[model samples]
Target: MDFDEYVAARGQALERFAYVLTGDAHRAQDLTQTALLKAYRHWRRVTAAEHPDAYVRRIVTRSYVDWRRRGSSREEPVDVVPDLPEEGASADPAERVAARDELRRALVTLSPKQRAVLVLRDYEGYDDAAIAATLDCAEASVRSHASRGLARLRAVLSEPTVPEELR
Candidate 1:
């Protein structure tokens, strides 16, 4: 497919990927825009690749990692969650949102590269080799990141709901 068509088809997904990486809607949009602009310059090369989406996703992932390394995009995580709409007075939706938020919060504790590795491997179901290629790292590094990331996430998520200070 052509560049325009590719963007049309994958734009939202790409933005969502960035959102997962950055945890901020505005930053996600910026990251997606940057990746797409870069891809547009080499549209022919990108589209000619066997998995063009993966190619563009690599752009987004690498940009995110690089941005994190540079300590740019100083967006802070939101401390307050907006009220969710009540679904027929059921609390299930709220619970799910809480879980998702908890996971997002837990994810932020990971280093950017580790977060990228986990998101690509677990969230996106990419294999280690693919993640290595996407992150421009070795497969062993991918495995190390994924292992440490998961461990960190578990530790963060398993903490008591009541803060130790509260306790």
Candidate 2:
């Protein structure tokens, strides 16, 4: 497929991948844009690869890691907590949102490589070999990262939820 067609078909997926990797929408957009730009510059080479999407995804993951290493991705603390839905509000959606937010918070606590391994293996459903390829690490390293990442996530998520009144 041509570069433009490939992008049109896969841009949103790439953006979502970036968002999962970075845990920030704005950062995800920037990461995706940067990766796509780089990929565009080598479009012929990328498209010639057996799995072009994998090539682009590797770019996104590497770009995120590099951007974080440069220390330009400072996370600002939220000064105010948003009000939770009122009592008797639709319970399921609220619970799902809270759980998702909790998970996201837990994810951000992981080291970048661990988080990338976890996301690629668990969220993106990639195998260890594929994750190793994406992260440019050994298969054993990918397994190690995923194991540590999951352990950390479980530790974070299992912490007792703070009472609402405590806020």
The model with the greatest lDDT is 1
* Per-residue alpha-carbon lDDT of candidate 2 for residues 1-167, written as tens digits (9 for 90 to 100): 99889989999999999998887888999999999999999999998999999999999988887787787655543323333334565478976687667666666677788988888887789999999999898999998988888887777666565667886
Q: Model 2 off-target regions past 4 Å? A: 76-97, 160-167
Return the TM-score for each candidate structure. Answer: 0.82, 0.82
Sliding window of 10 residues with minimal summed lDDT for model 2: 76-85
**Model 1 reaches what TM-score against the true structure?**
0.82
List, residue by residue over 1-167, the lDDT tens digit for candidate 1. 88778888989899889998888888899999999999999998998889999999999999999989987655654343333234553457777777667777666678899999988987789999999999888999999998999887767666555544764
Single out the weakest 10-residue window by summed lDDT for candidate 1. 77-86
Candidate 2, RMSD to the unseen true structure: 4.5
**Considering only N, C-alpha and C atoms within 3 Å, which residue pairs clash in candidate 2?**
none
Q: How does each model score on lDDT?
A: 0.83, 0.81
Q: Clash totals for all models, in order?
A: 0, 0
- With candidate 1 superimposed using the best TM-score fit, by how many Å does residue 35's alpha carbon deviate from the native? 0.4
